[model samples]
Each structure stands twice: as C-alpha cells, then as structure tokens.
Target: MAGRWKNDLNWSDTTPKAAWLNRRQIMAGIGAAAFGGIAGPALAGLGAVKSDFSTVEEPNPLDHITSYCNYYEFGTGKEDPARNAHMLNTDGWQVEIDGLVDKPGTWTMDDILAGTTLEERIYRFRCVEAWSMVIPWVGFELSDLLARVGVQSGAKYVAFETALRPDEMPGVRSPVIDWPYVEGLRLDEAMNPLTILATGLYDEPIPNQNGAPIRLVVPWKYGFKSIKSIVRISLTDKEPPTSWNKTNGREYGFYSNVNPTVDHPRWSQASERVIGGGILAKRKPTLLFNGYGEQVADLYDGMDLAKFY
Candidate 1:
C-alpha cells in the first residue's frame, strides 16, 4: 500500500493490491493444476534448474539466494548478475575505506581476497517484508577480517556503501533506491562469525550485480543490511543510516531482521516469494535468517526482536 514499485521505463503504476494479489493467486492455481497432471514433473524440474546455485551435494537453501541475486546495479533481472558479472573489472577493483580506523587507505579487491580464505559458508538470507533464500556464500568469516583491521574503542557502527559509476552502471542514474546504496551494522554484529565479507560464489568471480568487488553477508538480518558492491567500509561512533532507511524511514530500518510477527509498513513480513526458484513455484514460508536462526539466535541477546526488526 506504500512505497511505489513503479517506474517510467519498466514498471507500470503500482497495480491495485486486489488485482495483483488475485494475479498471484491465479498463478499459484496454474501451478496446482499441473500438480495432478503429467506436467507435474516438468514443473518440478524447473525448481532444480532455477535453484542451481550451489555445486554442493546437500544444496543448502541460503546459498541459492546469495549466489543468484536481483542486484540490478551490475545489471537488471535476477539472473543478470550470474551471467554479466564476469565482464566487471574485479581484478583491479579497489575499496576506498575511510572513517574511524588507524589505517585508512584504498585496498585493492585482490589484496583483500588474498588475505582472506574463501570458505563456502552457507547462510540463510531473509529479506524484510517477507521473502527468503539460502545462499552458499564463497568467502571468509567477517570476524577474521575485522580482527585484521583492529578497530578502535570508539567505533560502534560499521557502514557499507556501493560504488557509483554512472557510465558503467545505468541503474545509478535513477533514484530507484539510492545512488551509492548504504548499509550499516553494529561493531559487534559486523564482526560476528555469521557476518561474511564475501568475494566469490559457485566457484567463480563475484558477480557485479551481487556486489562483485565485495559484499557483506549478515545472516540474522534482512538482505539489505548486507550491502553489496561495497566501495567503502567505515567504523563510526554514531548509528549510520542505510540507503533505504534514509530514503524511507518508516519502511526500512538499520537492524531489519526476518521476524514474521513484526509486519512492515506496506505489507506483512510473514511470507516471501523465493525469486529465481521459478515463476510457477509457490513462495515458501520465510524463516528467521532464511532458516538458520538456530546458528544466530543469540546475537540479538537482551533486545526486543519486534522493536529492532
């Protein structure tokens, strides 16, 4: 009901909630129609095709979303990053870091990769306002990287932002979300084991749309909290505002967790359509941390999930 999803070039005026909901329902019905028919296998086969994000045998659900993202900065559409990211210049990509740090310098992406080991840690990625995915992230633990940085005592917030290259990325030209997409996490949260500084995925170079240069992966928080295409990483004393929160305060939050009880302003945060999993497929019930809550529930400690979420 709030925050328009419309645009002049692609998206039309926001559809009436009833019609859109009905369309979605009818689509689900169509999928159900094939359930009893010989086409059932055909429909089921599509899930394996769309969800082919991980080469691992078990195929953790979290790895599927992180590996295949709708990050349009590198390009539009869900599959764009997986296909077009190889064209991005990641070899010489440099992350310009500033703020509360003793050693503030532009570090090349290669150097950062060399310092960190690429561990395939599967994490649950739950988006705000319901929707979830599993991604087998190929990267090192955030704790290991933060330990190397040696943060000062005053640091409390860790802010991340995407690089702005209008000539290369046409998405930056419009105010779809924000020019240099920003995201932040508390000092302790940024350094947690579940928090990852990913460099690659599916045994390939980091896709440009999915934060090719580098991206943060916070397991317990919403997808946006884990900013992508990060060109800057800073430690700050004050609470840093994120891109969506800055633009729409009521809709977005700095600590947006995947809480089914606490609904977002525009819609309920209970369920999520797992995109790229297939168009005819049904959106599964979103889990806390895309379903790995057991591994990260304690991070929220003495706080209220409803308020923070």
Candidate 2:
C-alpha cells in the first residue's frame, strides 16, 4: 500500500529521490555512527523505512524546508528565521510538563529521547498562508510522550509554550503577536497517532530556524498549528491560548484545520500553492483533512469542521 503511494507520486511535483538520498547522511544527529553506520547518505535508505503513515508524494528538499520557515522568535520576514534563529541556545534544552498529569516536571531533551524509537513520516505541510511543502520528519508519536507523563482523568486539552529569551529572540521584542507563543489541542487530538513530537527532518537534527530541539507536528491541521521550539507542555481542562487566535480570533480560530470549503476571512482556501513546486507551478486543489480525512475524520465526526475551524 505504501509502495503504491510512492510509485504514484508525480516526480515533477516533488524533490528528486536520488538527489535527496545522497545528502541524507549530512543530517547532524542521525549520521552513520548514530544509526550504526548506515551505508546510505539519504535517510530514505537508512532507518527511515517508508511507512504507511507518510503522504503519497515526495517531500520538499531540506534546503527549502529549512531556509523558508515562520519562527517569529527570529523575525517576521520569510528569510528572517534562517538568519536570526542562530541566536537561540538549545544546549541542554529542557521541557516542563505540568498541570493535569500524574508526573509533572522538567525533562531534558536527552531524557525524553533516551528510550524513544524514531520513525520517518513524509507529511504534507500546509501553511495558513495558502502555501504548502511535503516534509520528511523524524520523531515519535505525541501520544508516546504524553503516556510517559501519565495524563490524568480530568485533563481535556494539551497546551504548549515556546521558549522566551529576549536576548536571543528579536521578534519577541515586537508586540506583533505576543511573547512566549502558545498553542493547544484537545486531549483526544493530542493522542491522535498522526500527532508527533518532531525532533528532526531528513533524518537529521532539526535546524534552529525550523524548531530545533523539539516541536509538535499535527499533520491534519494547518502548519501554524504545529508550534515550534517548544519548552513547556501542560495538560489542562480548558482550551489554552494560541498566538494567532489571540491576535485575531476571527482570522485564526482555535481549531485551524485546513478546509477548502471554509475560506479564511482574508482569502479563499479553495486552492494552495506548492512551495517547492517551482516558479511556474500552479495552485492545486486543497483536500479535506489535507488528504488525511480517512485517518483522522473520526476525531471530529459530529462537529461541523467549518464552525470549529
């Protein structure tokens, strides 16, 4: 089944597999030594075995995915994150898991990844701005981490917070959105298998501009819903504040699912531009659940996605 998707991919629409494979070994943390001297350079040949969890298309190149990003902590421009995110210090990074959990405290990145097994997922990343990219992310399911903390019975939602350091983060100084950007998801949504704690891309350690250390990846939702550079996670009974929604609720709703039928107040969501699809690339039809409804539709079975979105 997975092979069918890989074979059906429109090569012209994605990064070439052979070229991307050759550069895979360059990923920082998952080098040959890290994966027991895997012979190939590309992650696709190493431990990154193709899985049914991935999308049918090929992923965008690491260069495009890393160079173009929205890490407001660095700056507002599309090229800002790549240039300014370097100021961030990720060494010995730690995450504080608190609120309605059985075990709540600070856990170092090493500790969190110690026993976790990594897997590759080629997911479609759709930004709220109507641009998209296919990414090969490396990490474990978000549910696995949540299980480690032992969610309590009363917990209904999961809140996340990005690190705040005025000295390192220049964008925080501006009142653009808010400091220490926050995002949240329903407990069930967090537990969904499609949700993951992404640690790397292209099977290598994630770049600082691209949410180094750790970040959330909710494939079914818009890209912004997948917050980056996370430092805090909490289990709560109420919905936590999200940066965009807090800035303007009318434009960015709590559940920012990708719905072509429901257009954003500023523009239509009926179609989106593919980021790595080249200068002449045309907009493609946006899919329900980003073409992942079969895997995640049941989560919102009774609710009107248009209203919730």
Candidate closest to the true structure, highest TM-score: 2
Instruction: Score every model by TM-score.
Output: 0.72, 0.87
Model 1's lDDT to the true fold?
0.65
What TM-score does model 1 achieve against the real structure? 0.72
Q: What is the C-alpha lDDT profile of model 1 across 1-309, one tens digit per residue?
A: 011223233224322223422354446657777665543322331111011122232333323444566666655566666665555565577887678777777888666766454655555567674656556566666667566667778999988888777667655656677677788988878876667787764434455666776888886777878888788888899999788888888888778877777788899877887655677878677666555566667778898877776
Give the C-alpha miss distance for residue 84 in model 1, angstroms. Answer: 6.5
Candidate 2 per-residue lDDT, tens place, 184-213, comes to: 999999998889898888877788999988
Which residue pairs does candidate 2 place in steric collision? 25-41
lDDT, candidate 1, residue 254? 75
lDDT of each: 0.65, 0.85
